[model samples]
Target: MLPSNTLPNPAILARPRRRRSPMTLGAAFGLVLALVGGGAWLATRTPIVNLGNEQQLSDSGLLQAWKDGAVIVMIRHAERCDAAPGPCLAEPDGITVAGSQAAQRVGQGLHELGLNGADLLSSPKLRTRQTAHFILGQALASADWLGTCDPQFPAEAMAHKRPGHNLVLVTHNGCIDHFARQQHVPGGERASGYASALFVSLDGSGKARILGRLNEPDWQRVLASSGR
Candidate 1:
């Protein structure tokens, strides 16, 4: 048998590891803090939408509303350069080629939804006008109110709703955000990306209620659902 003093004790081998040094612990904590800080920064940079408690309309519902002339669709213009916002009317750096194609697809989707005799209006900006033309296969009326991010613009547009005709406005992200805030749209809603549509329903009293937002992918889903 081995001598007790010479042999290593099994209990000693089974002992828990020693606690790390304070400097090492602090470095680890700081790394965690850095990672958490990065995540928060990313969240702040990301755009978020709040749909609130409003009922979201399905694809069929939206199509029916369009047919009933009770739908008001507000869509942001397709992709543009990352340059500073300026008068797109006078500027040449408008929508990218991919943006144009995306607008065409959106237009096709609208046609599939039976966009018959709908009144389409676009911001005076070149990108918006281009999107409207691509979608409708014709020039659209230019609306100065849609060219800016004025919060009152949506309400003003809704006030002039024409019976038996759905209205479509192609504008900017700022304008859409302004309208959403004015309508008290709830949070947890996904932000509309480029070429996305925000569908609203107009009542007999000319009051407009938000239905929900449909992004490019959502449109595809709707199309697929209908086997289109």
Candidate 2:
């Protein structure tokens, strides 16, 4: 006969092990994703202006947005055929035929975008004035307030514009880029032309912020990538 061996308690054998909860792990992962996605949305989302086609900046769209408040659009002088960065030799105007054509394109685009009410301003330089004329369809008086190259000009025109006015400034690439740096917008390092529009937003707090940049090449892409 075998000796009776004490068997391990049945209660101990039946006791359940303390395993990790799969639901808890899933919840933690979901929380992480939510936080990451929210941050990405905020990082990419900016107040920069929309540079999309007519459908985007229509009268009922971006233009109206400015009309409700102050909207400033700054552009570098149009494309110049001059091999070197100097005044044009053939004409007193620094702008060439190509540049003139580009200016016309800008005018047409502005008209389509319903910015006819835009208060156009320009640099005193010949090229800048000529570009402005093409868009405004008339020789406009140079604004000492708008010329960036001129040392006497105001430090910042956007801050100086009176209440209830929309300003579109035609100036050199350098000045536009400088303002872009002050506002912290991208792509100011490269020379651009024509339908490029850099839009900034200044809240009631009196701080000018880089809202958005709309270039001719990827105007729509900027909008789409922004997820707005």
Candidate 3:
């Protein structure tokens, strides 16, 4: 007696209701747990570096390792001409020919790390400028951080410059000494045999951690790690 338009379609009525299987729900939950566990494990793993050795870090190699985000690199000006230590010889006349060559090595190391053209900063000392020019291949702006020649400057100014640009500094032993003492690192007994480079990386939470220390580090590994 009902009209065809008023009645439900036979095809719609004939279709069976389907329920989700319990197995499917279990599989999804397992997958979620596995992913979460894997992520947490990854977070706890230490960051790696490929320093073949301490004394062979090349400038080109290190450049490749340099990365974006906030990082600070400190280098003792390659080998200098100054033989004596005092205020009289404290003028900033940078590295000798051999020292410049060493700077080039550091520059090459920087390039290898991944910084094509990095933000160069330096102390007011001429040697620091020369070191920056040789290693970074550019004139760097002098910063109070560099002038302080204190390794703990970054620690002091964490709020202002902790998590910004990737920076490099060319300075003397005093900065290294202060940094080593504050960081609990032994730079060297005397200044003569104490050439080294220190790389510091800042995390998202603004905590700085030591990434590498090379009495003479391998630049290649440093560059590759930064890219990663």
Candidate 4:
């Protein structure tokens, strides 16, 4: 404690208190983004958008892309039997019974989206095959690469994507993750859940546009909101 104001220094009294500069909006935003998901916001590639809500989906241009037959929809197979407690749909290697029901619902949603000109395919794995059957109401062509989860997945997807038709692929989680990675999705981001779908548009000549992702249960909400 200084001598109780015995004689305050005139210089001290005349000195102004220094004020700290407030953080800039950009800096604050960068900080927040970093804390939550690193530099994904600043990344040049488009970040994976979650179309779980009405606002996001409505503005995502997903419907128009679907109508134009320029989208490739990747769907992760539903719950696996060995990993899930539920009874298997048929074999221990296949998806669970409940998963089949979920797959059915997803299929209905795609049907509502009008699969008339859509090309549906699945991985050769048992789980994916079973899921594809449930979603498509029949067995479809099995592509070995769908189960490969290769580094060339992005190219393969574009190669399979028809110029005038939507391509619906029922595959594995790793395969979906690989696709998301190609979209520049951060590894810290959450993986696609069972029966979840990621929509990508081949709008550009060479660059693929990442439309958005839709979870299994949000199909009804997305469809209901689109009013298409």
lDDT of 2 by residue, 141-192 (tens): 6765565544332246665554556667777666666666454444534344
Estimate the lDDT of model 1: 0.73
lDDT of 4: 0.87
lDDT of each: 0.73, 0.60, 0.60, 0.87
Candidate 3 minimal-lDDT segment of 10 residues:
186-195
What is candidate 2's local distance difference test score? Answer: 0.60
Better of 2 and 3 by TM-score: 2
lDDT, residue 128, candidate 2 = 76
Best of the two (1, 2) by lDDT: 1
1-228 per-residue lDDT for model 3 (tens digits)? 998899998999999998889999999999999999988866754432324443333432433334454666777766665743433223445556666666777777766555645456677777777777887778878776666756566564344443446766666677655654554443343232223567666667777655656554455454455453
What residue runs in model 4 are displaced by over 4 Å at the alpha carbon? 1-41
| Number of the top-ranking candidate, with lDDT as the measure | 4
Q: Report the error of model 4 at residue 153, Å.
A: 1.1
Candidate 2 regions with alpha-carbon error over 4 angstroms:
1-64, 84-93, 150-155, 186-191, 216-228
Worst 10 residues of 4 by lDDT: 38-47
What would the TM-score be for candidate 3 when compared with the true structure? 0.57
Q: Of the candidates numbered 1 and 4, which has the greater lDDT value?
A: 4
